[model samples]
Target: MAPILKISGLSKVYDSGFTALKSVDLEIDKGEIFALLGPNGAGKTTLISIICGLVSPSGGTVVADGHDVIRDYRAARAMIGLVPQELTTDSFETVWATVSFSRGLFGKPKNPAHIEKVLKALSLYDKRDSKVMTLSGGMKRRVLIAKALAHEPEILFLDEPTAGVDVELRRDMWNVVRELRDGGVTIILTTHYIEEAEEMADRVGIINKGELMLVEDKAELMRKLGRKQLRLTLHEPLGALPEALADHGLELGKDGTEIVYTYDSQGERTGITTLLSDLSQNGIRFKDLDTSQSTLEEIFVNLVRNQQ
Candidate 1:
């Protein structure tokens, strides 16, 4: 199937001569949740802005669904719904009023039922009559999502949707996002929460310094770049590692009570068998041992750091 969105050689340069985005090329499939991860000023927002038609690109092309964002601005924009990082709703407007107002902005006919459904989906139905300023921070965030979905766009862009939300509310939003994707809305999310991407995204893209560093299936990326570590608790605290273990590149724990070995999971030979044998020969005894794989956050950090 053709991607729902396609970005080719997208570049953005500001009047201040700042290049916010490089030649970024990406394709997002329909009904999939794609997470774009990056540090601040990494062009994530700039990229999203260009695609949503809020910011024009200095160079490149963006096509949403079947419409060219540049040539068919209105149609392209109608296919997309953007939930910005900051709240911009009118404080005096009721929840229903603001959300319905958003739909009207796209020249969409009044659909009370659609607005109500969006409110309920975001758990804001009860607050529909409440003023925006009266709701708590979390509810305000929900209001933003409701407003974005009010127009029923085929593609949704959530830029740090859960930035200041608490853990429980954030997880709730994750579930809501999944339901949206299940209902056939292609989602493009940019988040500082790496775990959010790890928990929800089917594919992950890493951006750094205005360049898209890498994009891959989340599982495949983890398998390809993830490392595993073996930690053994010694039966007795060894004052020092045996000289015979020098080749293993082993690290002694702070108190010398633990032994650590880090190895690439993709390696043909992890050297575990040899390390164990060598340890036994050198009179090393372990009471217990455990292994752990690198987390998405760890891999993310390493990738960004290496690029720097």
Candidate 2:
């Protein structure tokens, strides 16, 4: 299937000669949730702004659905909904009015049914009559999402949508996002919360220093990059690792109560049997052993660190 959004050789340069994006090429499937992860100044927001038509790219092409972002700006922009990081809403307007106004901005006709559904999906239906300024920060965040969905966009860009919300509210927003994706809205979100991406995205893209580092299916990315650690609790304390175990690159754990071995689970051989045999040959006995795999957050940090 053709992508709902396609970006090719996308480059962005500012007036001060700073390049915010560099030759980025990406494709978003029709209805998948894609999480774009990056550190501060990594060009995440810049890329989103360009796609949403808030900022112009110095070079490259961005196509939303079947419309070119530059040549067919209105058509491309119409297919996308953006919830920016900053809270810029008509504070004095009621929730319903604000969201309704946003829909009209895209030249969409007044559809009270659609607006009500969006508000209710975000748990904002009850507050639809309340002034935006009177709502709490969390509620206001919901209003932003409601506003984004007002036009019933095919693609949504959420730039740090849950930045300052409480944990409970964040989780609530996650559900709303899932519902949107489930409803066939292709989602591309940039988030500081790695777990949020981990929990929600089908694919993950890591961006660093304005470069597109890696993009892969969530589970595949974890399996290919994630390392596993085997920790063996010792039956007796050993002040140091045995000379024969040096080849295993073993690390003595706290007070020599355990031995830690890091290995790639995806490799053909993890050498667990050999390591165990060597340990036994050296008078090492393990009482218990457990394993753990690297998390998405860990993989993200390592990738960013390597780029620097």
Q: Give per-model TM-scores.
A: 0.95, 0.96
Candidate 2's C-alpha runs over 4 A off are none
Q: Global lDDT of each model?
A: 0.94, 0.93
Clashes of each: 0, 0
lDDT of 2 by residue, 130-220 (tens): 9999999989988998999999999999999999999999998999899999999999999999999999999999999899999999999
What are the runs in model 1 whose C-alpha is more than 4 Å off?
Answer: 268-270
Error of 2 at 220 (Å): 1.6
What TM-score, to 2 decimals, does candidate 2 have? 0.96
Q: What is the C-alpha RMSD of each candidate to the true structure, in Å?
A: 1.6, 1.4
Least accurate stretch of 10 residues (summed lDDT) in model 1?
262-271
**Candidate 1, pairs of clashing residues:** none
Give me the candidate number with maximum TM-score: 2
